[model samples]
Target chain A: MSESETTTRAIQVPILTRVEGEGALHVRLRGNEIEQVQLKIYEPPRFFEALLRGKPMDDVADITSRICGICPIAYQMTSVQALESIQGIAIDPEVARLRRLMYCGEWIESHVLHIHLLHAPDFFDCDSAIELAKRFPNEVKRGLKLKQIGNRLLEILGGRAIHPVNLAIGGYYRLPRHEELAALVADFEWGLQNSVDAAKWLKGLTFPEFEAPYEFVALSCPDRYAIETGEIASSGHTSIAVEDYEKFFYEVHVPHSTALQARKKPHDSTYFVGPLARIQLNYHTLTPIAKQTAEAIGIAPPCRNPHKSILARAVETVFAFEEGLAILKSLTMPSRSRVPYEVRAGEGVSATEAPRGLIFHRYRVDGQGKVEFAKIVPPTSQNQAQIEADLRQLLPQLIACDDAKIALDCERLIRTYDPCISCSTHFLNLHIERV
Target chain B: MSRVIRRVVIGIGSAHGQDAIGWRIVECLGRLGIDDVACEFARTPLEILDRCEGIDSLHLVDACIGPESGRLHQLQWPDERIVALRWTSTHGIDVPGALQLATELGMLPTSVTIWVMECEGNLIEGAWSSAWTQRIETAANRIARTKARAVRGEIFYRCDRTSGL
Candidate 1:
């Protein structure tokens, strides 16, 4: 087409009403070629890290947990672990088990919500969970019930579900008795079976046949699925210690986005995170039943489709319930709730798998235990550029369609990340201008 | 014998500043020694849903942005105005969305009431002023009186923000 024949078309979504936080999307097309796709996260920077400076290290977990409501446990766990590392406090074995158990509750709660209420509707072409519930009431109810079971576990262990108050720097402020945890056995047993059923149900959803050569990244534990703690691993790159994360992956400020987009070193390559990456990297470490459920449902490793992330999330939900059941059945009160630690000055870094993906936290504390410097890299920020890349790849498939369909397809693709834009500094209002 | 109604009042907020109106009012009602009513506080709509399974009457209290600050509005379920109320949720469903989901799944209480306090500034965080505290107390007393009337099976009419508390 000649320059004069080229016409500009702009498509804009003023506010992405679905998903968390506030964001907008802008796509520019020139003639038949796609020019630019920007996932513009317009939510103001929360300055959580800046606010942490000068606060006592004991206060980091509670302060960081406020970053994301859905995944507060992740924030609390990562921040607490980092501070504990700085102090060189060795937590008790039983406390470690309880921490893992608490993480299971988070995974189950966060993943199930995304699977049933958030992402599942896309597969069924419904506008919202209420619409999805109208057609799949049983599935939705099962999901909600499972989520309640997860939250119940949090309430039992963390003191409350949202920003659990139980976590201390080394361990917990208070520990629940064996009976309290034992009470969850029946619910978790129900949850395990229901999640298996839910995964099977989710597997039947038609996923788009779009796959990217993603650099799948997750924390890998030697003995079990990486949840509370693990070494960072990626499919396309060498494993690195949590402390070396900044050396490998770095963030950059783009003109259109308020959130900094992360890229791997050398070539600034974008990578994937969250459930799919975790499953891809740590498939062998999943619980016996969870592994069986995933294979039985045809969600094998090397699963590359982003749309099938819903499946990955479901399988992890099953793992969370199964893992939770084991912990409950073997429950015992720890001899001490928290380990004693002396005030010292040092820097510490730690990584843990949140329900969404790997979240890393680093803290430098003074001799008085006041935090002098703090850095938190949430999974959503790491996945932002990767999401934009996925949309770029996805647009060609949608380019032939009308602008509305193109925008909808892009949003559908983005929701698969279950991006806690609120945590990443979040929403997608889409504006596509075609020239 | 007439079956006793199981009523639950859930306060939804972060328990901070102006947002604490919901949890504070619920706390005030507890201090008032309201009889035979369950009082709970939640930060999310799903949390509210989790507490509603066995209840017969449900009341939700939260802070929202409206035309006037410190004004309390009592809107019943199925009311169109309740759907438009701006309640902040970082993730997942909002109040109206949660109610709609409950309705769809046949889990919403037959008697559902939403009590929202109008916030003056930022929706996520706020502090309670002396005036705000007074309003919270007044709202709690009014809610307590209303619940008492409901228990007695008296005719209770739908109330708007302009109506007497």
Candidate 2:
């Protein structure tokens, strides 16, 4: 269209094989020149904010959780934290412990879901886990059984496996009794072993050599890689409280897509965050079993390549199970199932490390306790730019490969972030023009 | 007279809705304490697809949508068998689209049998419909009987136990 526009950006994903939300990558190239690489998120936006405006704070958890059927716990946990921060009420220790355990279940569920069902098949060049099931029945079933264990924890503790209902501001409506939770342990322990096997199994797959410099960020606690809650930090040494995210980070809407894009202040360049970042930054905090497995995989302290992310997720699943079992062992029924609260008005930010990465919720409440304003940042939105960066790096290598192989390779790279564009869609129809 | 299935079965659509209850009817058979029946909520039709990886027989359950108001009808695919129509369901694409896609993708389970729920009479909206609600009762009963046989492995043309021939 323009004299200087020698290159065209083209990206197209027919079925977008591995990721949960359907989408495509569009990149433009000129003769020997790279033009544009856009990580187009095409999933339809469900308008969760408009849906949340009229509801009371108590309903925020359930309403927002429904936004993504795959990662509801992230929504529920973040909403609860924000609402509780607004009320300035602290939950009981038993309730806190129960919440952490549930968070662990979510981590296991989300990570395992991404690893086994969505991402792993890329290694074997398969379409879906079911297809993989036909080839490697034992491995696929092991992963599913392990994931089922995590889902069972969510079902029993959070009230339903998919979109749990019991968790609330002060605490869960009913803490799962030890006996109820104990039944899960046997399966969970079995799951942990299978998790080890699963991780080892994934390690045997072929890996790519493409690596890009990324702004790795997550909630890195002093004691653990924060999956539920912690301070926000990037490898760039920029660390801030959850409340300060707006000051250093910002969201902008791209004309090509509906999902708002996130960028660090000043530059619109992309940064990476999620399992790779979380694992790389907090390798020391991993549970003993997880650490050992990581070592066995030669992942060292931190894993940087996006291709090895399935391993990071697998290791995190092991930690989540360990953490959940410990928490479940000590949880008791609260004296009162829920703490009574009167909605007092204020603005607060609730942040948690979702399975993929940092998830934050900011709420402004009225004196009567209805939400006046709300904003949420999912991990996928934050990792959009970095996903494109990886694509840019991988595209040239994809040359000479078959269209199907290229598609599979690209999808695997995207799933490495476990992107959940379920709430937003910002994508352009990719045009792969040969200059 | 030679026996032919005169039973009108109604299938309810659930893929678009949460719980995918239409398909769950097929899924619930094993737990409901029943035996010797066929049911399925197929995304596609393929012969020998339902044959178990190890076992020798299969039953299928799938969602259905059609003209019968709270009624059931029979149809077959790949391996032809009567599909009992039971109820109508909420689905984006029609039953034909789902089956065709599954067949193309090789996703359809083998040895398929299904019942369609004709739902023009009563559609369960919001919370589940009452079991006593008359329009839905017949369909539910059809599903129950359909599922009963699946639990007995009579309709499950094959079960997965051993890998590869």
Candidate 3:
């Protein structure tokens, strides 16, 4: 291929690396005027919802936890909440506190993993975290240490870090000992300070100037920053009941991708979820330290720039650590390990703010307490259409740049959302065709 | 001064089809009740770094898509002619890449050995193939015996070489 021939034609990245799962990106151009941008996800659907049919209500949490390795607690929490809601089981306040702590562990592990290992490298123009570590050893080490602490917290409360076996339909199989919870206090104190420092450190990184008008969606709680559970809240002040998710947001099948794209109805437009959405909508409810960190970093709400999501995630990590420490300090043994309940036929729906965004789980149980139908809406699928929309808005400005540069910029934009394609249906091949 | 070797056996695989061999082997080792060696299950290769930290020796077992079915291939780290092994998950980091990163980050174990069983038949979420059941059992017993020997101060290096079944 001659130099001019290469310069005039397309750019193709057969596979997208670093991001979780399989996907491809295709960009079609008509002499510098971009024709189309497609973020194609080709990972075969695992049929998780279909497979849940006939499974007992007791098995829902464990089964759904297999959806993603990174955020199993989110799956377990959502499924457990749905199952409990179906039976009209209101958990003990102590049990609720423990669940929130466990969820914080997940948020810490997942956010640290993405910020330091997965997404941070993109900012420094490195291939992987290993390469980034070579130059910034101290920062990488701090991140890994924070991650280890998160894993340890999970191990203590949930029995295992990957897929916790201790969670049950109503609550945990057994309540942890006071000593067990107290042992983590010292480490969590360090972790809280470390997270604050990490956020400040990430605030100093260079971010590309780009922002899209996004309809942010997340769970909003009246009391605290929502993580474990809340109603589906949108930036437009639309508060939809968890059971009413289908009425507000709908998933549509696109021919180019196996994962379904979700859009808010009535307007029928794409919306954003995940860190940026959560922080913007619930910044007031964040812990005092978290709010201070956000302010110190100049990350006040209404954050439109996707790249600043790294900062948002770090801020949330601080909140997780602070909340975890508070929960540990106020720990009390529950009167009962779990609320005893008889399972009856009913339908239940729940939505929790996962590390990425809002994860909704709806299940219809038969009279025999077996799952009749299951529907799960992960964050990545909800962000797919918005990702494409962002690319559409950003690509025209970069029309004169080389194809490779445009492709990398596109990848950086997608990673800003920390899209877990594994949880959704998974990328990404990049093809930029010029006609 | 003689250094004490802390050994860990990690079985890496999913419940998908023939891939369950790793979990099966780890279960078999657990049945042996070995007090000196630790046995763990890893859902993905990227978890290997966490499982291997501070360990003196490591043994990993997994099924692989290779030339021959129901056959075992043994590989040791630091070998110049190590065959490139690719993990099946596109979502998680591959084993070799993760190990390389671990080494760079000073997290890799002192010694590493991997046992890969060639997979056959459907690679779906189901039962293990009957053809490899006996092979898995034999490999598990061998690994157990190796752990017993190592506990007895037997320092064996490059003991099992790859051979066709």
Candidate 4:
């Protein structure tokens, strides 16, 4: 071997910017060959699952909601559905519609926040949202306004915007008054138009040209785009009930991450989730305008480019706004907020589409309505392995650049996933070592 | 009618440990029932933008990690150091970034002041001690009585040396 080829080098990014939670990235290179790529999640493990044991099943929704500030509704919704299943409780159709509306609020706020503040900056080559705001003040303001409307919906329906207290096992604790819902109609209409414009604007941004043959995974619903609940579907031609989530997908501990990485069972292959995956798998179920927007932007299903996930997120934002407005216009205060049920011992599992991706929750309850076992697989953990795999595929293109350039490129690609490292036991400061 | 200055006091923090100082101050302001001043609580710095509309004057209180546990620091609007100091956040933008975004969106009030209480060590999940409570009360009282002083663009520290609960 030549002396240059025998040398070792490292590239490290000590802090990753523009994504959620705490995490760092490390890459090792031997000559021109990539040795390893690790998406390190060093945040101390939060024992939420362990804490749920022995708690009342009724309290599970509120407790699990504490897991992610951005998508508390996702956690709350999945947890309640799981518990409700255990009790053999079927919600009133009106109650279910309102629940879907509330989830739309979460998707709108979470997706808009990510599209504008978190991911857009990378495309613009800006260091932070502040920089992006200076360059595109109008766009940023519109995004913020849309996010605020979503938060208002949550405040009205779920209680406060963060860790909303209104959710219960069977249904909501209190129904929103018609007047309160009526007041938001004007803003929702404006948001629906604005999101379409935002998606068009996002389509103009220059995204990196990289596509992977990823196995896209998301929830598929027969009646509509899956947000609140559905069967698990993947691009690899696999469909399974939510109860069979464990049989299809499994988590394994990796040394570099505090969060367990998820992989497809049997083959142990990495699969993608979140906006890109959802959009590809559920395109037919998207709202009319959302479909129109996606088509207008020149992106369709089978878009494997991770960088264009921003476009997918923008399209979803449009769908969320339209869906929310329809529900708001027709929803009335239900006679009873929740259906009553008797507690009995049983086990149940549920999957729902969070803004980021599909989140899974399962619980085993005793006859006393106490939790016997609890499991939560957040979207970020499910995407961690896929993220690392993307990085590995991306490194060859970046290897020719300097260490700093390579680090920046890697960070940009990882941000495409919009991984809530905090939700995943998250991180990224990048270091590339060459030997 | 004379111009009615719409003044608002915003406390930014979570529910855990000394971090709750911001929330505590707002609670104290509410309990004191200071007239003509509105009090608000912000879980994160970004939420500050949501409460800034149509207000003429804004006062923001938050906790910071500095040299001392109970020392109080104050800075006025346009103070450049406010952005340089430890005021950013990992969740998104920092307090200063939100302030800037608010300014850009034309939502910032004409007069602004920021008060940061410095605490040392890891901020655990609980309430503060009696001495800290007394300090928070004193801060609340001071904010109620005084408007933004002429100390514009200055950082002043009110480090209390006396130690008793």
Tell how far residue A28 is off in model 4, in angstroms.
0.7
Q: What is the TM-score of each candidate against the true structure?
A: 0.96, 0.80, 0.91, 0.94
Q: Which of 1 and 4 is the better model by TM-score?
A: 1
Worst 10 residues of 2 chain A by lDDT: A423-432
User: What DockQ class does candidate 3 belong to?
Assistant: acceptable
Error of 4 at A318 (Å): 0.6
i-RMS for every candidate (Å) is 3.1, 9.1, 3.5, 3.6
List runs of model 2 lying over 4 Å from the truth: A1-13, A399-405, A423-431, B1-112, B116-135, B145-165
Q: How well is candidate 2 docked (DockQ)?
A: 0.10
Ranking by lDDT: 1, 4, 3, 2
lDDT of 1 at A331: 76
Q: What class would a CAPRI assessor give candidate 2's docking?
A: incorrect
**Retained native contacts per candidate, as fractions?**
0.56, 0.00, 0.26, 0.44
How do the residues B10-64 of candidate 3 rate in per-residue lDDT, one tens digit apiece? 8887665776878878887778787657898887676786777788788888877
Q: Model 2: how far is A32 from its true place, Å?
A: 2.6
- Off by more than 4 A, model 4: A423-427, B66-69, B87-90, B120-130, B148-165
Residues A111-198 of candidate 1 have per-residue lDDT tens digits of 9999998899999989888999999999999999999998988988899988888999878999887888888899999999999999
Per-residue lDDT of model 1, residues B1-165, tens digit only: 978788999999767766677998999888898767899998877777688877789999888766677787877788776676555565657788889899998987788888888766764444555777798899999898888887887735566636233
Number of clashing pairs per prediction, in order = 26, 80, 7, 25
Comparing 2 and 3 on lDDT, the stronger one: 3
Clashes of 1: 26
- Cα-lDDT of candidate 1: 0.86
